[model samples]
Target: MSADLTHVDTWLFDLDNTLYPVESGFMKQAEARMTQFVAKTTGLPMDEAYELQKTYFRDYGLTLHGLMEHHGVDPDEYHAIFHDISLDALAHDTDLLAALQRLPGRRLIFTNADDRHAERVLERLGLSALFDDVFHIGSFGFLPKPDPAAFDRMVEAHGMAPAATAFFEDSERNLEPAAGLGMTTVLVGAHAQDSHASFVHHRTDKLAPFLATARLKEAA
Candidate 1:
């Protein structure tokens, strides 16, 4: 069944792999940076650091969160270093830009990355003007997605009605709380096919096409 978007007045999107295709290697660069940061800070070998980075990401929603919790890492310092990656891999996605422009109402970015990283990515993709605002990890007090409390704060801060909002994310785990809060959840990317979670309202391998052909509720 197709999702009815007529009732959706607010569109929330995740950054990174959600907005851009994972094949672009943008996240690959970021992950490499994470590994380097971990190696430098923890004084571990590159391979061991990479493994630890993944462990932190798996245990904590964001690697930064894990570093903060265990290593008492300076959040600002870590953020600045982690996001210092090249955006050369990303290109302006005109199709996505056009699709976003066609959608009615508020369009916002809900990302685990900081606003600086989000801004740079959006700029690189030529989507800087489409979104109304960005709700980054800093906005959630360093609490990343999948944390129900972070979702609560976002909804409250934005003054959004859950039922009237649609959240598009690449991570199925992160979408769980959005669905639980009554927002329509759309899982994006190739991983969507692997999601067996009943909470996912829609699945699309690509976001531009989904938005292009969305079935909107009829105007009453």
Candidate 2:
């Protein structure tokens, strides 16, 4: 079905891969820290930690969740160690800033990462001022995206009408809950899937260009 792309009063965007280009290498550094932490904490080899991390991320909403449940790892420590990386490689995108400004609505960030991490990235990318608020994983008691409970909590807390909101995310699984709630789900990233299996309502590799048509397209 062709998306109507109208009546979006709230623009919810995911951090990390959604707000910034996935190829920025920030996530690569974070993932490396995660692997290293997992290996050190679980007494596993680096290769084993790598596979386990992926499995945990697949099975749980996030790798940190799995580590907490299975290994009793503290979420705070996980965030501190993994999210402490430098963002020297991330470049500010003026087009994205302009596009975001053009999109008429209350722009908010919905991220699985912690508050500090989200702040760091947004600060580095020069996009921190664009968002009104950022609801991080900690706000939902460490539960990440794709969890209906977390979504419901956020919706209720913000008094957000799911039908009038548009959520842009990089992970296909994360979009499922938003779509289920009648929110328009836009898959963002270079490798975003347009498969029928996905619940995504739209797909865009370039966020700035896609958002450039935001008001006009939705106003149609």
Candidate 3:
């Protein structure tokens, strides 16, 4: 009935949809920006660009990766333009920030977004200082999630033991590999439905309640 944080020393949290609710229009705005970027770079129409972006995300785990592999575009430039949207469109929720601060572990943000974007979002949510560090896309040579190399690098960089870490992500596919590496996996979105690993621990729509219960259980 409560979370056990005993074996978990590092809490790896996903940014975008996991930090904030996807229902918020912030995701939509970011998607639009990505679409526009693709269109501008490829000289395609908006709808085609949007489709291409989706295709790339589906195929390569990140639109930027696909762009790099195919179009030879600069990853930094793509991130700067696509993720430079206003964080003002997102609603403030400090309750989650408080919960994150109270969580019993070294908290780190593991996101596919660039560092600038991650910094902006965390700052807007008043959670910038709560985290030990942020592992952005740029951190691991633009290697995104679902890539074992990226996860491995994150573990090594943070000096974390795979068995003593828990990864909270929005994507089931991403969590699957982390689970395989012996990390407890918490799926934090509707899209994360199927996973073959028992280490895939919790599935929650929101993180605040989960964190509160986990903290209470730890106290008890």
Candidate 2 or 3, higher lDDT?
2
Candidate 2 collision pairs = none
| Rank order (by lDDT, best first) | 1, 2, 3
Model 3 weakest lDDT span, ten residues long: 211-220
TM-scores for all candidates? 0.95, 0.94, 0.91
lDDT tens digits by residue: candidate 2, 77-187: 889995658788789899998888866668899999999999998999898888999999999988888889999989987889898899998888899999999999898
Least lDDT summed over 10 consecutive residues: which range in candidate 1? 211-220
Please estimate how well model 1 matches the true structure, expressed as its whole-model Cα lDDT: 0.88
Clashes of each: 1, 0, 0
Residue 142 of candidate 3: its Cα lDDT? 88
* Residue 81 C-alpha lDDT in model 2: 92
Candidate 1: where is the Cα deviation over 4 Å?
217-220
CA lDDT of each candidate? 0.88, 0.86, 0.83
Q: What C-alpha lDDT, on a 0 to 100 scale, does residue 23 get in candidate 1?
A: 79
> TM-score of predicted model 3?
0.91
Tens-digit lDDT string for candidate 3 (39-142)? 99899999999999999999989999999999999987887775557777666687886777676768899999998889889888878888989999988888
Candidate 3 Cα misplacement greater than 4 A, ranges: 190-199, 215-220
